[model samples]
Target: MTVALMWEARAVAGRGGELLAWARARELPRVPLRRETFRAPQDRVLVITWWDAPYDADLPELPEPDPELVTRAVHRWRFEAVDGD
Candidate 1:
């Protein structure tokens, strides 16, 4: 099975770049099959990591950024592929 973990965060008023850089510099204990990072208008950063594991398997995920860097706690979601192909 394959699972994708989504981590999203909204930086403080003017710390978007720093937050983005911080996210980019983080290293997971193990690398995933695929990973991607994205940014949005409201200084929001999103990182998705794909892994080959069961839905409930233990997987590496990005951690929360420094409290001073974000407006609130980070948001995370886990998803598994549902296609029948």
Candidate 2:
């Protein structure tokens, strides 16, 4: 099975660009099958990592950035791909 890990964080007030850069520069624990980064309207940054592993496997994920840069705690989610190419 394939696991998709999603990480999201909203930067404080006007620090979106800095936060995004930080996220972009940060490295993941391991190289994923695929990775993607996104920016949202509310100064939100989202990173999605796809891994090839068992459904119940525990994978290393990116740690949250400095608290001062974000409005609140980072959000993370895991999903299993139902279909794929």
Candidate 3:
């Protein structure tokens, strides 16, 4: 089964672009099947990575960037594929 991981962060005011760039430059220790990035209002950045492992399998994840670049700590979520999707 496939699994997906979501990572998110909120940048400090007026630093959304910098935060996005930082995210784009990251190189995870374990590459994912697919990865995507998104931007939202309020300087938020979200990244989703799809992996071939099972939902409960141990996987390597990217660590948060410098604390000075963000307003709050990063957030993460995990989801398993449903109906073989």
Candidate 4:
């Protein structure tokens, strides 16, 4: 089985690039991670990370959180490839 974990967070001003670099560096070895950006008219920014990993299998733990760059907002999910396709 495969699962997709979606994370939505708000990034600090002038820090999104730094955060992205950090995330790309830390993403798991075999997992697939992708990001998308959205800009609000008021200048706020939203970043979403879509991470895919095998389901019902142990996943590598993530590193310690960075306190300065990202603030986690919502985490919602739907199961995929539930029977391992």
Winning model by lDDT:
1
Candidate 4 clashes between residue pairs 3 or more apart in a chain or in different chains: none
- Writing each residue's lDDT as its tens digit, candidate 2 over 1-85 gives 8999999999998899998899889887789999899999889999999999987798878788898999999999999999973
Give each model a TM-score: 0.95, 0.94, 0.93, 0.48
- In order of TM-score, best first, we have 1, 2, 3, 4
Q: Give the worst 10-residue stretch by lDDT in candidate 4.
A: 41-50
Best by TM-score: 1
Compared with the true structure, what per-residue lDDT tens digits does model 4 show for residues 13-78?
667666555554665655455555455432234444444655654544334346666555333443
Assess each prediction's global lDDT (C-alpha) against the native.
0.92, 0.90, 0.92, 0.49
Tens digits of per-residue lDDT, candidate 1, 1-85, equal 8899999999998788988999999999999999999988789999999898999998989998989999999999999988841
Location of the lowest summed lDDT over 10 successive residues in candidate 2? 54-63
TM-score of candidate 1 to 2 decimals: 0.95
lDDT (Cα, tens digit) per residue for candidate 3, span 5-84: 99999999999999999998899898899999999999999999999997899977768879999999999999998876
| Model 1 stretches with alpha carbons more than 4 Å out | none
Candidate 2 regions exceeding 4 Å error are none
* Alpha-carbon runs more than 4 Å astray in model 3: none
lDDT of 3 at 25: 89
Q: Local error of candidate 1 at 52, Å?
A: 0.3
